[model samples]
Target: SQTIHQWPATLVQPVGSPLSLECTVEGTSNPNLYWYRQAAGRGLQLLFYSVGIGQISSEVPQNLSASRPQDRQFILSSKKLLLSDSGFYLCAWSPLGGRQPQHFGDGTRLSIL
Candidate 1:
């Protein structure tokens, strides 16, 4: 089956604490990966994207950052957490050159206290 991996599925973090979220894609080769954040009543915000290994582009100037550590692995991290950073984090992948539609994994719900 096609699958995308993301964790932790839920996170409760104190303000100012560090944060790390990981995502990996399976059953696909060299997919274009994307990181997105969805807040209540808001549209999906594209945070980062990678078309190839180590080729990352940021779409927003938020406090979060993303990295492509491997061909199928992506990591989102922050040295300090903020209340505004809390949201549903989604990891999605699509075939390159916009040939196919994107698919998303179960998102990680993050809350800051």
Candidate 2:
């Protein structure tokens, strides 16, 4: 079975600090990976996605970026953190070239102080 792993489970970072979050998948290859951020009660916002290695697509213009350095690895990073960046970030994956359900990780709860 395929599983998604994301970490750190929670984080508290000061404003203007650099940020790095990683997500990895096991038992899958060439899966479509996605990064989403949810603020408060708002719905999940698509931040970035990759259909293959080194093929990242930004869903919106934001203060963050994502990279797929390997077939089953995804990383989200920011040069400087913002107060608005504090939220629940989730990493997910679905089968490539299909409308299948995505498997999500436990998520990372980030708080900017």
lDDT of every model, 2 decimals: 0.92, 0.96
Judged by TM-score, which candidate is best? 2
Model 2 per-residue lDDT tens digits across residues 59-84: 99988999999999999999999999
The Cα error of candidate 2 at residue 6, in Å, is 0.3
Could you tell me how far off, in angstroms, the CA of residue 108 lies in candidate 2 after the best superposition?
0.3
Question: What is the overall TM-score of model 1 with all chains considered together?
Answer: 0.95
- Tens digit per residue, CA lDDT, model 1, 1-113: 66899998999999999999999999888899999999988899999999999899999998888999898998999999999999999999998865689899899999999
lDDT for model 2, please.
0.96
lDDT, candidate 1, at 78: 97
Using lDDT as the measure, the top candidate is 2
Worst 10 residues of 2 by lDDT: 96-105
Superposition-based RMSD of candidate 1 using all C-alpha atoms, in angstroms: 1.0
Q: lDDT of candidate 1? A: 0.92
Q: Which sections of candidate 2 miss by over 4 Å?
A: none
